[model samples]
Target: MELDNIDFQILWLLTENSRIQWKDLGEQIHMTGQAVGNRIKKLEDNGVIKAYSLIVDEMKVGLSYTAFILIYMKTSNHNSFIQFINEQNEVVEAHRISGEGCYHLKVKIHSQEKLNLFLNEILEYGNYSVSLSINEIKQRNPLIATI
Candidate 1:
């Protein structure tokens, strides 16, 4: 879909704060609340807006550790490994990538013990490397850059 300046403006506002009221958004963009709602609905229908989410502190939720695991798998076992990873709740994101490892996983766990247990479980499949994030420098959706 061809997204014009208004659509980009709507998205920019939403990206900054998804919970912003339609009336406030309208005021920011010189439109009525109903018009803002209509534009958002159109964006949703076109799949431009995929999902609404809240950014929560993992530490507050008892998940304090965030680990990146790189896995090197045996050939012909990709699907089985993917299925195994999919069943693991601690795995927030996984990607098959090019380079040294076949897959990379982003996981959050309550403690080091849980992280160890998860690492031990995956070791049965193949070799892997784990790195814990000390701090997050920056994170943002690329859609905002398009604006």
Candidate 2:
């Protein structure tokens, strides 16, 4: 959908804090609360606003290990592999990619034992390269500029 500057501003505001009241958002963009609400509803109806999510601290939840698993699956086993990954709650994100791997998965587990078990299970499908994340340098809301 074609988004005007107000729509973009609304999206930007929502990206930063989804729970922001319509009155507050309207003040930021110089629109009425009702107008802001209507726009947000329209955005949702059009599927522009897919989901509202919380960015949880994995460490606080005892899931300190963050691993990226690059998967290589047999061409014929694509569907089965996809199903397998979908059923795994430990997998936070999965992406079908190009270049060296068939899929890349971002997973989080509470312990190394769980990580090892998860890895061993996937090895039955094909080769994989796993890396543990040491630190996160930067994370930004895609809707806004760094400055």
Candidate 3:
């Protein structure tokens, strides 16, 4: 569906705070609560907005390391690898992409030892190259960039 400016505005606002009341969201976009609700419903039905998520502070959660892994699958069988990632708590995000790598994973760990253990386990499916994040510069909703 082609989205109008108001739809984009609603999406942008929701990305900032999904918990914002429909009335409050409407206020920002100069619409009524019912109107905003209707727009949100349509967006949901169209799958433009998948789900709401919580942002956890890694420091508060005792998670110290943030690592991005570029996976090179060892074989054609990927079901096992997908299942392995799903079972691991540290893998926050995983994606199959059309680029230099087969898969990309974003994970958080507590220490070097933990990171090493995770990397070693990954060898069951494939060899991986990892980049550790020393400091997070920015993390914004990707939709914000398009808007």
* Candidate with best lDDT: 3
lDDT of 3 by residue, 90-118 (tens): 99999997888799999998988999999
The digit string of per-residue lDDT tens for model 1 on 48-141 reads 8999988998888898999999999867558888999999999999999998999999999999999999999898788899999999899878
- Ten residues in sequence with the least summed lDDT for candidate 3: 137-146
lDDT of 2 by residue, 52-116 (tens): 98889889989989999999885655888889999999998999999998999999899999999
Candidate 3 deviant stretches above 4 angstroms: 98-100
lDDT for 11 (candidate 1): 94
Positional deviation of residue 59's Cα in model 2 after best superposition, in angstroms: 0.7
Task: Kindly indicate the candidate among 1 and 3 with the higher TM-score.
Answer: 1
What's the distance in Å from true for residue 136, model 1? Answer: 1.6
Candidate 1: list runs displaced more than 4 Å.
Answer: none
Model 3 score (lDDT): 0.94
User: What is the C-alpha local distance difference test score of each model?
Assistant: 0.93, 0.90, 0.94
